[model samples]
Target chain A: MKEIAEKVVAGDVRTVARLIRDIDDGMPHVRDALKRLFPHTGRAYVIGITGAPGVGKSTLVDQMISHLRKNGKTVGVLAVDPTSPFSGGAILGDRVRMQRHSMDEGVFIRSLATRGHFGGLTQSTRSAIDVLDAMGKDYILVETVGVGQDEVDVVRSAHTTLIIVIPGMGDDIQAIKAGILEVGDIFVINKADRDGTDKTMSDLRLMIDMDQKKYKDGKWKPPILKTQAVFDQGVKELMDTIEEHRLYNFKTHGDLPFRKRKDRVGQELAEMVKARLIEEVIGGLVESGAFDMVVEEIVSGKLDPYTACERIVIPVLGKRP
Target chain B: MVQKRRLRVMVAKPGLDGHDRGARIIARAFRDAGFEVVYTGLHQTPEQIVDAAIQEDVDLIGLSSLAGAHRYLFPRVVEILRERKAEDIMVCGGGIVPEADIPVMKKAGLKEIFTPGTTLDSIVAWVNANVKPR
Candidate 1:
């Protein structure tokens, strides 16, 4: 594990890829390598791009890779696609769009399948990001599985989240919906050569105005940009805007955006705790037959779920909350 | 939680082949067979395919070429993988190759070749029987 972690930190592509695969497979002993890699993370800036399907997210990401590489920054991309629920498999076609960067040693593109995970990302996305970060990438671009409202977990993982929409997609209404609108650090109207480009841009500007009314002084406003990703138009300006946002974040939140980093680490800790508790406590009960007894009692209407929970907890905690 | 090891395959359309109907079909078939399939779209160079296969840590690569470049493109992919020390990634070829070139391709390190009319099931079954996640 130490050797693997060392190789990953030294930017060995094969070792990093294998570690990420192990994370995706949920293989045991991966946590040891991740633990060793933890302190080496937080060096890369994580940017997330998300939008509905067919909104040109992958095309935009491809352009972004080119722009970033031109600026002499090493990049790591994690492009996710949804898994097939019926077959437990996925056609990770995002790489199809970014194949131009396949031979570029400065860029590493990885495709991830959601593997039954919701929230527009796979369960291993965070760990994969860390692996990339520890590999010494200057920038990490996480392109979520084309997302809708409420599949906004990308906000928690990315320092800058770009919400992409094409013109004439009724995405203005989607932008007004609860979950996705509030999470954008930048709004991009890709495929801007299409007809409804001005309408979508104006609509996004109006929404941004309304959303900005509640912000305090020095808060970052999500800028709306227009781009024809297929034609590579406006992509350089988008890269400039992203760099501007990165600098703004540094000025507002110190060198590393301490608050956001703390929040992300806190969330990671909470998830780990929840998983560990379920595995240790609940798994123990299920193994000892107590959980089965409670389930049978509840199914037969002899016990209520709230009381059953209390009964189960009292034995474990020796008191009721 | 112990998750089952899953196979990762790259279905690449190598060379200047503009026809990708067979590649797309086989990619979907692999997905339906419960393997993660990474589809490299039209006109991939051997270097691009080998780089992607290494970066993805794919267990196998299915090279498709309908433009009659399999004799060169297919073996070139295997040769590059061998040079990169990633020859553990199994290489297979499909589409428009003549029967006479099969021996040369095999000699160059292609593990299997699926010509026209090969059933999708048989290909998937062959991958299942031959490749294991490393």
Candidate 2:
């Protein structure tokens, strides 16, 4: 485990990918490997790109990868694809779009299926990013499985989020998807060569103006830029704007948010407690048949869950008045 | 020794083979049979397939070719995997290959060849019995 963690931190692609797979599978070795990797993380800048299906998110990400590479920055990409509801499998197509960098030594790209995990990512998306961070990537790009109004979960996990839109797609509604609007640190109007480009930009400009609260909290004003990702136009400015945001974020937020840091600790603690209570503590008692007695009463309609809670839950709680 | 782990398979089409029915059916079959299948979209080069196999850490690669380039394409994949020291990843082939060429391709290291009438169940069973996990 220590050797695997050391190889991952040394940027071995095979070991990094293996550790991420282990984490996603919840294998026992992941905890030890991650504990060894923890000291090397928090270095990479995580950028998230999200948009409705067919908004050219992958194309834009491809351009961003090229731009970042031209500046000599090592980049890692986590491309998420939706699981097919019927097959429980995914066609991870984003890597296909970014195939130009497939053999680039400085670039590492991993494709993930949403796999029934919420927020358009696998449940271990955070762990995957942490492994890539430990692998010494200068920038980590997380492209979500495609976004609906409520698919802002992956964006919330990133330090910077880009909400992409295309012309003639009723660009107004997408700009204000309630959830994405809160998380979008930058908005890109991709496919700017198409018609209705002016309308899309105008609608977004007005919407951004109306979102005063987005600016009032000493929050950075989200920039709306246009690009034809296929032609690689305006991508340099996108890269420049991203660098500006990074510098600005460092000056303002300073590494990490104290409140979010505290919330992360609290959340992890709650999850650990919940797992122990459900899997180890209550689980053992349930196996002892105390749970079956309550279940049998419920099955016979002799006890309600509320009363069952009173009778069976008190003993599990260990102490009560 | 057999180990308890999900088999990761890459069902890829190398070269300009536009016919994907065989690959798609096999990929879906593997998925339904409880394997993790990564299907590379069409027009993948041999290098790309090998690269994907390594990045995905797949145990098996099911190469589908109808373009008759499997004679050329399939061996290139096996060679690259060997170059990358990933030769433990088993390779299989499906699609429109002449039966006469099957022996030569297998000699070049394709572990199995599935023709038009091959059943998905047979392929799944073969993989379950043959897949190596550590």
Candidate 3:
């Protein structure tokens, strides 16, 4: 596992994936491995893509990846999806659009399931980003499952979030405004060749102007760019806008809001501790047959789940004699 | 006696399908049934799915496509798996899979198809029976 971690830090995709599995499995060495590789991360520029569904988010991301590649930037993509209820699997089929980059050694693509995490981004997305960063990718693009709120939370983790909107969905503007309109660093009006492009762009511009008035100081103003992702129109400009935003943050704030290296490392450590403690407690419970006992109680209706949790936590909460 | 490696399964949803109440429930059940499950969140593509399976070196790829693209999408996933030399990993699918579509899915090399309301025991049994651990 240590050897694998070293290889992962050196950017071996296979090793990185294996380490992620070990981490996901709550393997004992997972945290240790990550701790060792933590220093190797934070070099990659993290970009997030989000939007409402049917807005061609995936198409636009595909275009963005190609654009990044042309500029000699190694790219990593984390596309999150929801898990299926009956199959216990995911229907994550969006990678179909970017099949051309499947074999590119410079491009690493991973799909994660949101699994009812409501935040749209998978917990695993961060770990996967760790892998990409260690591999020394110049840029990492994280695409959230475009379900409004989750998308917003997921993109909040990115250094630059580009919210893709399509023309003709007058309702989409209202919906996004009600949800994540303010969260975007860059708003992309994709499918620009589609009907109502002009109207949609104007409406978005008006909304942006209206919203900007709320902030007294001229803080972050999200740039609204028109793009036809399928035709690759305005992709270069969009990329430039993303860079411009990155530069703006560096110049004005002296730091990027999206690249909080300390916060991420702190989060990783906290999650590790939480996972470890849970494992220890649960391992003891299962070994003591406490788990089976609880299951039996639930089945027999002797204890409701809320009370059953109390039964489990009470013992752990009490100090050891 | 040689012990079998614990079967690791990756369950994922691809595309714009938002209905995941079923996927989450199954992930919990599979964990109880003693399989190490890696769930890739919704809206994943076939390439990403296969890439994950290959990277995880999982024994099975359990896809749940409830949005009705199973006919067009499932087969393409199998093709990618073959290309990645992961054809040996048993492919299974679930999630609103109509009884009628089972034949086509099976023909596409999907070993098992679990529909809605299927029990976790059945899924465990199928994995224990069909999957050969490498």
For each candidate, how many residue pairs have backbone atoms clashing (under 3 Å)? Answer: 0, 0, 35
- Predicted complexes: DockQ each: 0.58, 0.39, 0.09
Per-residue lDDT of model 1, residues A1-321, tens digit only: 999999999999999999999988767688899999988988899998988788899999999999889889999999888789899888999998999999999999999887753231333788899899999999999987445422366445788889888888774446445567787888899989899989888888887788666666878888899998999999988988998998888887787643246776687667666555555567678767888999999999999999998887777777776
How does residue A12 of candidate 3 score in lDDT? Answer: 73
On residues B1-134, what C-alpha lDDT tens digit does candidate 1 reach at each position?
A: 33568999999998888998899999999999999999999999999999999999999999998898787889889889989999999999999888999999999999999998899999999999999998
Query: For this target, which candidate reaches the highest DockQ against the unseen true structure?
Result: 1
User: Which regions of candidate 3 fall more than 4 Å away from where they truly are?
Assistant: A25-28, A116-122, A148-151, A213-218, A253-315, A319-321, B1-128, B132-134
In model 2, where do residues sit more than 4 Å from their true spots? Answer: A117-123, A146-151, A171-176, A255-321, B1-4, B132-134
Best by lDDT: 1
lDDT of 2 by residue, A82-137 (tens): 76677665566677688778788899888776664322132367778889989999
Off by over 4 Å in 1: A117-123, A146-151, A257-260, A275-321
Candidate 3 per-residue lDDT, tens place, B1-134, comes to 01123456777776668877777677667666655566666777888778767765677888888899988778888998888666877788898778999999999898889987788888878887888655
Q: Give lDDT tens digits, candidate 2, residues B12-98.
A: 989998988778888888878767777777889999888887888778999998888889999899999999888988998888889
Interface RMSD of 1: 2.6
lDDT for model 3: 0.74
How do all models score by TM-score? 0.90, 0.85, 0.68
TM-score between predicted and true chain B, model 1: 0.98
Residue A255, candidate 3: Cα error in Å is 6.3
Q: Clashing pairs in model 1? A: none
